[model samples]
Target: MQKSIAVVFDSAGTLLHMYRVAKDMSSGDLLTGVESTDLVARRKGRALIVLHTEPSVILAVDRNMRVIDFIDGHDIAIDISCASVPFSVEEAYDIIKDSDIRVDDILQVVGVVRKHCPEIFYVAAGIIVDRNDHSVPYVLSTGGRLFHDSKETVDRLKGLGVSVFIASGDSRRNLKQLAECMGISMERVYDIATTREKARIILELKDTYDKVLMVGDGMNDILALRAADVGIVTLQQGDHRPEKLEMSADVVIRDIREVLGIVESL
Candidate 1:
């Protein structure tokens, strides 16, 4: 039998909202460990550096920095943990040496991160990085929770014979857990950790499905929405920056259940 329209959903905002963890989400300036005074000096010379560090687990910043790729410090390594990669002291310095990023650029990226992660906190200006190569930052990131009845919505979509896929900036482990909880096939999930990757995945899905619908609620999902045949923005009351999403998506939905109706009509 011919397949119904395929739907791709962004994991963080579209499938689940931000569920608080131990503390509210916050970010702060990157600090230097001993002998690493040069790092802070470099920032002072060029730009103010801000970072979102979740101790022992992750360090994140906006993607525009391009610092994630060049750094190869002993304690620091870059990996696809989020849209932005985390770093340790040496790795962060590696990026600075290779890229020579300016202060204005760092400010711009920090602003974008602040806008998106409102729970973001700016750590103390002079937080010490210390000589400990494995020193973890004090800040911690929050978690995500599925929208009310989200699993039911996926089940309903499958009931209607629609092919459902997940494209998200979240870690593979998180997405895998979500897939298992919702009974979604692991093969159908894509760890699209960047905006460009999300759009690329949508295009790839388009090749297999006659029609593709992309649904999301964050700025990162904008490009993918435009790439799909139909883009739906799921709006929740009191949510941040709904207007931006409304403008980006082809259709604005107030409820996750609305997606089922939208698909049926298509």
Candidate 2:
């Protein structure tokens, strides 16, 4: 059997449920919610139900409220697509501020957003706050029902002398929080800036670890998944359909716990 040293897992969709947080206007508080097909925002106490539409638009519905407001996906995408600084919120803001896009155009977009999404607000604030902090706020939605199982798997892997690390697109701070939740140390979390960077981390670790296993469930994870010795694609909640060439994983599983079994088989 091949000896394995480290196992890398993606944060969202692999260990945590994919959801966004937004400010509820009625209560003036933040709420975590999943995107839904219905055009209504169902709120159970402080929880929320986000209405999702494609071409990639999202509407935040509060407390079972109907159609609070809808944001145009095109408007949101314009800023994101035009952003040259993919990792730096400050750089992204500088580009936006210096751009020729009129202030009116920006306001028009904001006017349509009924719920103030914390992720967007924090990024905007991060640009104005200290750029060194890397303070992109995230809503660490409650872990999925199987999250405890995932944590157990991590514990088991660690007990077997496997080094477990998180290589995720999420910020360092967010990854640290997740690591703490799973009882992993912050040093093991790798805050990923790009898909290629994720792969690079795996390559660098390979220098010492030799046998590395990467478990992921999104298109963003394809590169790192391919770079690892054994890439396992998880079919968990919030998993996106892997693009044609991006599905480069060596194995596929329905549960995260299965990753341990595959590693044991190796």
Candidate 3:
């Protein structure tokens, strides 16, 4: 059976009201209330690597094994497969090693985060690495609550027979919790997804659904937004939208609930 419509959403800024904090490895400066995409966009050779384990686990590993030493010794490639499931400390070590980043640099950033941001819940921990120089320029930690209208919007979309999927660059562990909270199945979530992967998901969904709609709020969502049948960019996050990002979408909206009306009109 062909589904009438499928809506793909970006998790962080789209459905979650994110509070992001980043540590600049070079200057030892802490940047609060920043956008992750804007940080990545402003720098070159930067790729955001999301860790799929709890912050406590990483802290534990750092205490016993010394995160710097473990990563310095291990030579592994970044494995996206581990993103889909919860990973062990050993797996997390390997994932960090894959970045080919200088372990010492990242450790300092992690240390600063531990000292200053003790109260944050830490929904996601990410490293912004310079792929060319093999150094971590920034380490970021994010915590967010689901938008007030997020779950209701999801329920409303489902009532209208629209399939909802979350495709984001965030960790799967967090996305799983979000899926459960929104009553979306785990199978519909794509975690640690790259920009290309998000677009690919939209393109593939087009084969089974009559139309595909992508709703997102950042530069990272540009590719997927353009690929969908209807690309909707939501400004509910209240962040500054880049001209390029806004131009990529077919429609611009202020709230996620507006999607229900757009879907109905389609």
Best by lDDT: 3
Worst 10 residues of 2 by lDDT: 121-130
TM-score order of candidates, top first: 3, 1, 2
State residue 126's C-alpha deviation in candidate 1, in Å: 20
Best TM-score among the predictions, by candidate number: 3
The worst-scoring run of ten residues by lDDT in candidate 3 lies at 76-85
Task: Tell me the tens digit of each residue's lDDT in model 1 across 152-223.
Answer: 999999998889999875555567878998888989998634667788898988888888999887666777
| Residue 4 local lDDT, model 3 | 96
Task: Quickly count the clashes in candidate 1.
Answer: 11
Candidate 2 colliding pairs:
41-61, 42-64, 43-63, 43-64
Q: What stretches of model 3 exceed 4 Å from their correct place?
A: 1-3, 61-66, 70-122
Q: How does candidate 2 score on lDDT?
A: 0.51
Candidate 1 has an lDDT of 0.56
In model 1, the runs with Cα more than 4 Å from the true position are 1-3, 20-140
Give the C-alpha miss distance for residue 31 in model 1, angstroms: 19
Regions of model 2 farther than 4 Å from truth: 21-91, 98-146, 238-240, 243-246
Q: lDDT by residue for model 2 over 103-127, one digit each (tens)?
A: 2322222333323332321111011
